[model samples]
Target: MTEPAFLVLTALVDEPRHGYGVVREVEELSGGRVRLKIGTLYGVLDRLVADGLVELDREEIARGRLRRYYRLTEDGASALEAEAARLAANARSATERLAARSGRAKALGGLA
Candidate 1:
């Protein structure tokens, strides 16, 4: 998954939050990289909810026109954790491979 989706999932990792709250949390977490548009948010949310990553929780605070709460499922947490690990491992492996190649090239008096 992309960083925005990951950030959104990570935002819900702590507690249930409404749509706007989620957008804010994701922005905070990603340092303003992932701006969750209303339509985009719902689209991602629908997929995540359908995939059992998130669920509708209690409505703690609702404005007249907006949905105001959702929590991550246990499955969602697990999935997020797994994806994070996978991405980390992939990054490490790629770094190591590039480092080795760079070393080899440098030793051979060649550009990487």
Candidate 2:
């Protein structure tokens, strides 16, 4: 999955969210790294909806505009979990390798 899709799914993992809510949540989750414009967000939403990864939960008229709320489907949740595990494992491997490299460097420093 793309980073945007993963972040979007994560934003809605805990609860349903409107477009603006999802945008804010994604920004927060990404530490402001991912700033999603409405058009981009809707694009991802449309794809996810078509893929059965997300569904519209409800809609409301707020401020004279229709506000749609969306939630993740079971498949979406499972996919997010799998992606998280994969990222975690990759991070662990990289960290271990870095630590080993740093240890060797430190040991070789005395010889140098």
Clashes of each: 0, 0
Candidate 2 lDDT over 38-111, as tens digits, reads: 99999999999999999999999999999999999999999889999999999999999999999999999978
Residue range 1-112, candidate 1, lDDT tens digits = 7666688789998889898899999989878877889999988888888998899987663556656588899998998999999999999999999999998988888643
Error of 1 at 74 (Å): 0.8
Q: Could you say which candidate leads in lDDT? A: 2
Evaluate model 1: give its lDDT.
Answer: 0.86
Question: In candidate 1, how many Å is residue 59 off?
Answer: 1.2
Q: Note each model's CA RMSD in angstroms.
A: 2.9, 0.8
> Which residues of candidate 1, in runs, are more than 4 Å off?
61-66, 105-112
Off by over 4 Å in 2: none
Question: Among all windows of ten consecutive residues in candidate 2, which has the lowest summed lDDT?
Answer: 75-84
